[model samples]
Target: MGIAEERITRLHQLAHEATASGDFDLAREYVRLARRVAERNRCGLPKSFRRFICDECDAYLRPGVNARFRTQSGGHVVVRCDCGATKRYPY
Candidate 1:
């Protein structure tokens, strides 16, 4: 990983820690900053990091708190956010 990727990884870790501590708002801010860093540096968030955030509400999903994970038919994975937004990924 290069410098930008390293920075992005660090930011994602911070967001995870913030969410774990029940400071969701802080986590959201961290995600926003991470995105900006990625954009400025011409990179994207790692695939694993992308799945932890709700695209609609920018919420950090804790897998049963603010988000629900379901396995759909045909090898699809569904993530439903508390904001009523759903994302389906074919895994």
Candidate 2:
């Protein structure tokens, strides 16, 4: 796999471990790291999947598209595209 993919996988593993160990903070941190790697790699959610990516920006579309709350877990995560555009979808 590519470096970004590897990093994302590692981060997921770390998050899982942290969650199992009751380390919500650590898990959240790992999630953040994964997001960063995904953003850097310009990886976006596939249209066939439950997510959508912005054509202008390769951000990962997540859930909570129009929620008032500001929680990161269920919200759409996206990366800024070259044209400074972003997309969102249900996580």
- Give the best candidate by lDDT: 1
lDDT of 1 by residue, 1-91 (tens): 8988998898889999999999999999989988888899988888899988888878878897778999988999999988999998888
Clashing pairs in 2: 57-81, 59-78, 59-79, 60-78, 62-76, 62-89, 62-91, 63-90, 63-91
Cα TM-score per model: 0.93, 0.49
Question: Highest TM-score, which number?
Answer: 1
lDDT of model 2 at position 83: 42
**Per-residue accuracy of model 2 over 1-91 as CA lDDT, tens digit each:** 6877777766666665665666756655666666677777898422342132334332233323311223257675444333445444455
Q: Which stretches of candidate 2 lie over 4 Å from their true place?
A: 45-91
